[model samples]
Target: MSLDPAAVRAAFAAAVNMDAAELEEWLETPESLSVGQKKDGALESVGHAAGRRLVTLLRSDPGALDEDAYRLMRKAVGFIRRHRAQEPANMVTSRWRYALMNWGHDPLK
Candidate 1:
């Protein structure tokens, strides 16, 4: 139920197709991503991979996890910015488009 940094890091590395060491170097400051920190291109890649991992965890069966911890996990996942309004619509993948479209729908609806 707790956020396993090691498992998350491993999943991120595989999801992003980056070397674990390389990602470690890049994420060295995740706990302190400064206001002036600018990754330009690389951060986007990492964020997307991390976001996917987070989504997987968020979508997992609720009863299988600690509700309080899951709530915090969802909050943390919400912080990732994989989509930007300024991006052209065509720039988004069809999969992302579908996911984004469904994202706004109420699951209970």
Candidate 2:
């Protein structure tokens, strides 16, 4: 199945408790991110990190993402986990993971 940017954004916003408008402003399309971009410091925001991950995921084949894409996805999962941990009562984690799985990515990995 094809990746849906709206769905990805919605899932990310839910997972991070970020405003969808804020996420839209922070999210850059996959084509805009340079290959040389560095991931050094803590991510700017969960929304930004999740948006980056979604871009990477969209660019790759879900069944076999390249190493860099996989790494990005893993980082996204980490960011999601960190945010989710802050709100133990929130049920968005499972829904977010389910969304990812539907896009052919098993974030559990």
Candidate 3:
């Protein structure tokens, strides 16, 4: 399935309980933007990596995320991690899993 970059960004903003405009700045950072390459359809491949980073941010910082958003982010992260684990051979999933690990969260755990 193809992923829409806009929708992923929107959902990520909502998940963090941040205004889309404010979130745009964070998303534009070199690290975040570098998650995927545009030439390889990185939007679809790297969307989950971006989401993982956001979730990790919220997780490591206290009071940075509202209770509801925290719960939703956890659920989303868990779901994505689980899905990626189930499809170990898929390149997109493998990349996402590696990204999660690089960010300090192990998808297999």
CA lDDT, every model vs. true structure:
0.37, 0.43, 0.46
Candidate 2 local lDDT, residue 76:
53
Cα lDDT of candidate 1 equals: 0.37
The C-alpha stretches of model 1 lying farther than 4 A from their native spots are 1-45, 55-59, 67-84, 92-109
Expressed as tens digits, the lDDT of each residue in 1-109 for candidate 2 is: 2444445444543444323343343344332232122355543433445564554455545556555554444555555655445443443454444333322233345
Q: In model 1, how large is the Cα lDDT of residue 31?
A: 29
Sorting all predicted structures by TM-score, with the top scorer first, yields: 2, 3, 1
Give the Å error, residue 71, model 1.
Answer: 5.9
- Cα TM-score of candidate 3: 0.31
- For candidate 3, write residues 1-109 as lDDT tens digits: 1344345435544333433343344455554444533446446334545454554554454445455544445555455555455656654445555444333344445
Q: Clash totals for all models, in order?
A: 0, 0, 0
- Scanning candidate 1 in windows of ten residues, the lowest lDDT window is 100-109
lDDT of 1 by residue, 1-109 (tens): 4566445444432333323343344334442132122266454343334434444544555455554434434433343224323334563433333232222211112
Query: TM-score, each model?
Result: 0.26, 0.35, 0.31
lDDT accuracy of residue 22 in candidate 3: 36
Candidate numbers, best lDDT first, in rank order: 3, 2, 1
